[model samples]
Target: MRARGLALKPYWSALQSSIVSGDDRMLFPPFGNFLVLPSVSPLYVPEDAKPSQEDLQAARGVIMSEAQAFAAEIRSAFVANLVEAHNGARTLDSPLEDVDKLMRLVTSAVPCPSGAYCSTSATFPAILDHFKVCSSAALTASSVSTSPMRVLAIQRVLAAVNEVEPGKVDAAKTLTAELYALGNEAFHCEACLPQQAAVGPAAWSNAHSTKMGWTKMVHHLLVRHTMLGQTLPTVIYTPLKPPSDSGDAAATAETASGGFVVEDAES
Candidate 1:
């Protein structure tokens, strides 16, 4: 059944590659390792069952590392596909739709702390034309959107475009704003901000923080001429820990900074 989804071959291959023993199983795609469903069925523990802080931190590190590896595979493949598309390859009747498919793959490939993931929308015109048309639409959507991941996704795409065609940064911020707006519409919950909502609050906070961080990073790269690194700052999203009494208490509260530090990504 899984093989039928050939586009997901990379993920399946990655999961299979990580398995070192018969005990390895799948809980989720981004998981580094897994036990049988029965072993962790309840998927929660009372306060007494919580692992020590040290153990929890160690586990988070492992999960974060695994998540980075998984995301790297997806990002690399996605970029390659986009570059191929930009190279005047065959037309995707709906290029945005294909981008969404790739985005879905991205979601499954990593444990995005920003909760918003990346912008779910994009449009690619030929390299020579102005990006304004597509970027304007994206910025319009991002204006009311809540997810920083969406904004960051737009930023990364523009950055990639600039890498291929230089001088694209001239209007990329406007593009970023549009992507941010789109994500805001799709994911942000205004009723939940300032800890008022009862759902996915940590994700909300993380998304907000990540968005700000990306905004700064983008400015630094595009305006200040910060050296480009191999990765974007958005890749290192680390969700803040929610209070133990919250509904998310079952979630480990250890620090999620595992990928926050990396070599410069502006290159």
Candidate 2:
């Protein structure tokens, strides 16, 4: 099932290849190195358990390292797929309007942090076109949205978690927003965001987060975004055009940042 879905994503192979094992830089304290990790609600940890100081520190390191691995993999994958899409554009009969849809379909197949936007209500034209659009959008004196910038897709997923589970969504939403903020700035802003700092607080330094917790959150977000038919589809999107001032590139100093499956230790 995983392999089948991954094939649809042009970049999944690279991202998954680099994720062979958690990078030791963020190595969490192994509860018991499972020859095979289990699948469950709180797969990484036993529910109601408190992490010891050693566990906290270890989890922080592991989560940070894993986050980096995920980010690198996503970047590589996106670049590869994007380049392919650009090349394919010349041969494919598809029109320019279909470009974002193609990118979304490819990205949806991967269970990475970068996939969050596939379900977004925002419209990101070709990122290469962002500066041009920003300039034009600003010139028209068109009013920008006052809504808080959040990952439109993950926001709904988080809201669902809040409804179904007793105490899960709020923290996830907070962390997700932080990640989104840092992520947007890094890619969209004129000044690149501080990926390390963005990921540190919610992931590295936070006491409540566990090695397994990081993994669980990532999986949950992906699964929630999947269609009931269990196949990728052309995403139906609502566009939230971003503000233009952010292109200045000077605001990348601060920001926020996790995981594939929840481990038993995370619960």
Candidate 3:
């Protein structure tokens, strides 16, 4: 049995090379985001077990829809950033910091080859491995096979990270679209198997017996409560309105007394 019930084979090669150097090249593969939507591995699925044409098309549709949703969110964020700049306020940095903190929580929850929050090559891989195992185990227990929809949910999370990049303010919108495209390609490739099992123990035990057993075993880990003990602070937004100018206040008082009425400058 693997230590802590977490299997580390899928990332063995990558983890090994980075272990001594403490690099994260293996943990955060080349594509981009890891949590929301990880870069799809072309070698994950085999040619003989490829998903059907119909499934591939369906996956494409789902990925595209997710791309659109991701785009809208990024657009909204961009607008908010612009408004903040115009009004002399800091744009989304505080929120971004909160997100990074949350990410740290997730990354540090598992027993990593390197210490939690340390600068080590194995650190990033540990985080990715943590997510993969947790997510896989969660789905397997419910008898729900990992599908394209799950893929979209994972990809959507990358937006949080993108929003905070030093010079990549617009990265959320752009990367979201790219993720969709990359996802479409990844899912359609021979490596990704189409989801077939329904949720429930019966389906998992009967129809998906072989796959579920292996899948769950490969990704299962018994995490301790201490690993997830941190509490997130609550954020509240209170809108502030600029005070009325002295000239505007005088006009308002005069109008109340029926002495004068304010008019638009153009009018």
User: Taking the tens digit of each residue's C-alpha lDDT, what string does model 3 give over 63-169?
Assistant: 33443353344334433433333233222345443332322221112122222232111111233333332333221111212222212223222333233322221
**What number of clashing residue pairs does each candidate have, in the order they appear?**
18, 23, 8
Worst 10 residues of 2 by lDDT: 139-148
Tell me how candidate 1 scores on lDDT: 0.30
| Candidate 2: tens digits of C-alpha lDDT, residues 28-79 | 1111111012211122344453444454344444444544553344334553
Q: CA shift at 228, candidate 3, in angstroms? A: 38
Predicted structure with the largest lDDT when compared to the true one? 1
Task: Tell me the RMSD of model 3 versus the true structure.
Answer: 27.0
Q: Which stretches of candidate 2 lie over 4 Å from their true place?
A: 1-44, 91-267
- Global lDDT for candidate 3? 0.26
Compose the digit string of candidate 1's lDDT tens values, residues 1-267.
212223333433454456554213211232212211122211223223434445434454455355345434444554554534333322233454344344332111211121232212222211101121112121111122112333344345345434433552333133322322212112221222335354554655543432333333333333333234423332222222322223432222211222121112221
lDDT-wise, the better of 1 and 2 is: 1
